[model samples]
Target: MIEHIIEIAFYLSTALTLFILMLPSQYGPTPRGSSDSAAEPKTTVQVLVLGDIGRSPRMQYHALSIARGGGQVDIIGYHESDVHPDISSHPRIQVVALPPHPFCLQTSNRVIFLLLGPVKVLFQVFSLWWILAYRTKPVKWLLVQNPPSIPTLAIASLVCFFRQTKLVIDWHNFGYTILALKLGDNHPLVKISRWYEKAFCKSATAHLCVTNVMASVLKKDFKLESPILPLHDRPANHFQPIQDDQERKEFLLSLSETAPVRGLLKEGKAEVIVSSTSWSPDEDFSLLIDALCRYSEISNTSKPRLPHILAIITGKGPQREMYVERISSLQNNGKLRNVTIRTAWLSTVNYARLLASASLGVSLHTSSSGVDLPMKVVDMFGSGLPVVGWSRFKAWPELVTDGVNGRGFGSSGELVEELIDLFGNPAKLEKLRIGARESSSYRWDDEWTPVAGKLLGLV
Candidate 1:
């Protein structure tokens, strides 16, 4: 019996060794032409930002940045109706849309995701590998976006290993932390995801994080040694404020089907409060609804009645229908008064236009990972719209000051008070508008050019 146990242990050890050997190692063969190509003409670096292109604005930004810098970029992403025209029309960037992943696997149910996640990832890895290996140019570097980090990094690492290319992981949030939000911290799948995260993060050639806080978390939690660069998202030039009132009026008229907005436009007294959300579980839309309801209740008894409010909530996500039903019920019950809440899935140009025309912006995003800053707030600021945002994470203070470009609130009640005060006082709103405009000079091109150049060895 002892001899049989010893034999079993030996087989297990050997199997583990073989599995380790099969994985893409951190070390690999030297890149092509390292020894003999010193005299060869310089070729433009070919970069592929592989991820969901339809939803990821940062990926679009990265591809555009490289292309604008005279590098060739092939963006392998999934198709969505709202994908920006700028990406498809770019001379130096090529957009390849991958087929949609399985619908059942993308469901919000944590158990379903956990049970079938590996199978889904295996399919993704196979498709991505085929594209990377045979269908594309000899890529010098591949920048992958994380959160769905397991398969993205795992497959990218394998391709990089064989092709002798560098893998740069742009870390937005940890996939495990996001899983923990839905599945709890102690779930077995979450534990396994955490392990995969650490292993894959360590294997990457370099890491680009959205904020300094994210970079710090990676260092402290994962003990990553690869160079980490903080690459925050900045506004594109198209996000600027509308210069012509006529154009703004025309756009407003186009949405006349929404009665409150049309009435406000006719009266010229509409206090448009725009909020862009992913409609995900992380965003507490109830808080925004509660605040609006509270403000309406207070205004009913107060002198100098509030102006008509047209609250525009934008973005598409799985939880959207749930919120829409909730809001519809409230409106039907007359609990929410005097405010017209419109939910829209706007195209890129329309989204920018809406932000540009809005009087104020609100962000209800409480980060699933406490490190990454909200890109929606950045986009709002870009359009010169002052924001009132939730202050739950460390990165909030970096983006907003209480009375500066935006205000940050900790609770629904506090947000209501702030909004009431702002609506009652026009001068304070003007000050915030000025502050937002002043802070809007930080553009994507200026922020990403130097970093992309350095990372790709162009500068």
Candidate 2:
């Protein structure tokens, strides 16, 4: 019995040795951060842009472009369906994949993600801390894209505290108010989240806000001394004009089948394109649709029929089903005379093309909906499309100088009135289009170059 056991053990040991020898030397997940001394010489400016890459393509493009343009820029972003390929290709731009939490979003593949959530969070936290500990001596600046969340901001603050690196908070939305409005103010989760937000904002050395309104709120409420730099997220310049005239004609012809184009060019039928992600109370797209339907009822038919409105409502959320139902009901009842609703995942390039063809763009939300100047607004500028919608938030008024580039409406009644006025007059639309192009030009460059330069003392 002893001799047989000895023989078995010897064979097992020999097999294990063979397996190890045959196995590949390098076998594991992709390496994180810089591995070689080559990335050592240049200034390392690590920028973390977490959550919703698709929502801010133009902003992401500019941020990544600027980072790579100067020195070593390491970018860690959340996993979106379509990722920016440039980041993957760039030598300096490191793309860290962040898996979504199952607890936060619903999915059939729940168990796997639920286990992964805690693991990912721990790994990310550890990786960030490791960067702080090891890379600080060489690192120059640390920029957090929207340092308003606890896990994200905590990492930024902790790194800044010990590493002695300059901390930049990219304030996309009012941390507390956005969560309170999005997930309900009474929510226990939001209450805890706000505490982290306040701490991070206070500790930040500098900030980048979407508009002057956000800066004011941060100054007044947070009592933060950090320079709240006003930067505009420029529109993504991906849309190339249709080279083939025949192809363009066919595409327009297909569109005419659904809704007849009555003198779209001759009489100048102004097309209003509204592409909003959220149909929630914050977005208030329902109000715009309601106001349009109301205006269509009262407006005179003899007058050049108010530019055939074509509003494309995209995205999926809690309010998605209800919004689709509402629009469908309007069409069924013949209440929606000219409005058209198209729902789907819009590629950045395709979305830009749609905006290019559109005569006007609109973004509407309530007063409470602050800090969320939808990235679509930037796309509107990139496409050189004028805007017309409710401008209650502080950013709206500043970004879109009402009556200059876009018309601002306070109430639902005002939104309706403005739409009517713009549709009735074609020349006003032309002037606004010119203004939009001019107004948005500054915003495009502001995203990365000037902001990064300011942070690095290069500006």
Count clashing residue pairs in model 1.
Answer: 0
User: In model 1, which range of ten residues has the least summed lDDT?
Assistant: 39-48
**Candidate 1 residue-wise lDDT, 98-183, digit = tens:** 76777766767766766787788888877776676656656678888887776777878777777677888888888888778788
Model 2 per-residue lDDT tens digits across residues 163-189 = 556777777775667656655788765
Question: How close to the true structure is residue 165 of candidate 1, measured as C-alpha lDDT?
Answer: 75
Candidate 1 root-mean-square deviation in Å = 4.1
Residue 346 C-alpha lDDT in model 1: 78
Question: Candidate 2: which stretches are off by over 4 Å?
Answer: 1-41, 103-139, 159-165, 182-192, 239-272, 299-302, 367-372, 446-448, 457-459
Clash pairs for candidate 1:
none
TM-score to native of every candidate shown: 0.88, 0.75
Q: Which stretches of candidate 1 lie over 4 Å from their true place?
A: 1-51, 243-250, 256-258
